[model samples]
Target: MSIDQHGDHVLQGMSIRKLPKVSLHDHLDGGVRPATIVELADQVGLEVPEDTADDLADWIAERSDSGSLVEYLKTFDLTVGVMQTREGLTRVAREFVEDLAADGVIYGEVRWAPEQHLSGGLSLEEVVEAVQDGIEEGEDAAEQAGHDIRVGQLITAMRHTDRSLEIARLAVEWRERGAVGFDIAGPEDGFLPSRHREAFDYLASEFFPVTVHAGEAAGLDSIRSALLDGRALRLGHGVRIAEDLDVVSRAGDEVLVQFGDLARWVRDREIPLELSPSSNLQTGAISAWGEELADHPFDLLYQLGFSVTVNVDNRTMSRTSLTRELALLAETFEYDLDDLEVFQLNAAAGAFLPVEEREELIELIGEGFER
Candidate 1:
């Protein structure tokens, strides 16, 4: 069951990468190809730590595995440095879709803070348009290559910044174009979703979908704020919500547990948790549980009936893909093909697309798995 260097494995006489999957928590800046970064940086006069793509990949992996969120975030500085221009943004966005399509992703949402990319004299609208252009090109390229993939933008705002309301407006502006939803992506500990109540309120008024990065760097209170203030349709790495559950006892396969009010609400409401296994381990998001992949409460949440969907929070940083994340969870929890299919279905259901498109995605997943 050893996964290859490409983050793929053979399971049940099928290749994991060939299975239809939905990506709901991927970050546009976090999943750039190191080689593309190097080339783009050279053209843009940006300095990179490593000259070669392989070395740059190793460099990102090292920095991300440093067990410090700040250190991990520093890698983004280099990636984003090369992505300030319209050409850079479009190229990255296009490559992101191609990568997902190659990984057998049928539907994906690429989230990034537009405010972060405006440093190079590009307007908010311009940045979104560039990314949208890239996404469409990527889709056309994938179709030509005999791989069908559809990706949308999840225009995100920095939680610690003051531009959330503005960013939310930008997302709404592009909803009919390529933007499918809105999100808040920076530090989540001190900057709870409540801080962006105005933006969330506006998004809710417009009937735009929202997802918040909660319960990852923070805890249950953050999750509460995401629901009450952010109106998050889904939780971004909401793994820490398990903290609210009290394990009373365990007898063989049955474990008795009591859920707090917040936990009960999240579970009963079936808010999808974007559980990223490798990223959670690298970022120490699951430190309270333990320090290994097996320590993640993903299986617990899944068993307890949380809408647990697997995701690759940052492919480059975590050195993972959807195939890799699913393989890690399957290996850690001894999950079979059915478990993997269930996770894909959960992601498809939680996607920001309309109900009809979601059902189409579900059908695609079912057919892919059946093959």
Candidate 2:
């Protein structure tokens, strides 16, 4: 199987982009389109690194590819800068959904921090309402374009901030409107999920779904805190959870390993790990293992019955889509259509939706893969 320049892959004599998929770790700010960024920046007198969309796209890819923390962070600065108003938020959200639908993502959870978009004087409730409006518009547009897609909001709070309890309450308040879950994003190391224990405790009381950004920039302790304190229903790029595994021996495809108590618990509990392949490499989340997709412990976790779901952590920065991530994984791991379908099934099951809707997504994946 070969992936085209457009990121489309022909696997098992079928277009990988045509297969129904579910995305659980996609970031709204991290996935903005270059053209949209340029236009929005112009409206706000924001100086962008590039003038044209193509140049801006290349600029983003270059900076992200640098693998420097400074460069990677600069990308977010640009995305978050233009998304400060109701108009910007709604348009970006709509485009996000449209892009996901075009990429064959039937269902997705868009995670972003409302606190980041409040620089324009928008209230928490106002920002959530604006995003929901855009989501509805995007869904209608996708349906009219002959694609059915659904995206829910995963309202996130920055870990470095102290307003998590407030953010958690905001998420729960908007639960029926658009917010489907809560999350703590931002620098993962130094700041553990336990730091937001009050927020987690309140979310638990409200019976809200939470997914913490752990095991990405940090290690085992972060994952443990995410599970025990945050009560995370899913993990955001929990790639480093492999740190808990001791690979005893490996002979070709045959291998033996000992699992740590945390690893065993996570695996046994079937907790979903939202693993983003290219982003994992770009962020050095799997630096301990190796510097390539082949080195990712995704296949290991999958083979061991860990609910591993593929994701595109940042579409613009990594210059990736869910289809491309899956294609890269397939090329690296020699995964077939069945394996891809299983990843999608895992994401659908791990979604913050209720059981009935998740079952519909599972059925859709099975049917799509059958074709």
What TM-score, computed on C-alpha atoms, does each candidate reach?
A: 0.98, 0.98
Cand. 1 TM to true fold: 0.98
Residue pairs with backbone overlap in model 2 = none
Winning candidate number (lDDT): 1
Superposed Cα RMSD, model 1: 1.0
Q: Worst ten-residue run, lDDT, model 1?
A: 1-10
lDDT to native, each model: 0.91, 0.91
Candidate 2 residue lDDT tens string, 1-72: 455324788889989888999989989999899999999999998999889999999988888875443457
Clashes of each: 0, 0
Against the true structure, candidate 2 reaches a TM-score of 0.98
The parts of candidate 2 lying over 4 Å away from their true place are 1-5, 68-71
RMSD of each: 1.0, 1.3
Residue pairs in collision within model 1: none
lDDT of 1 by residue, 33-71 (tens): 999999999999999989999999999999899766667
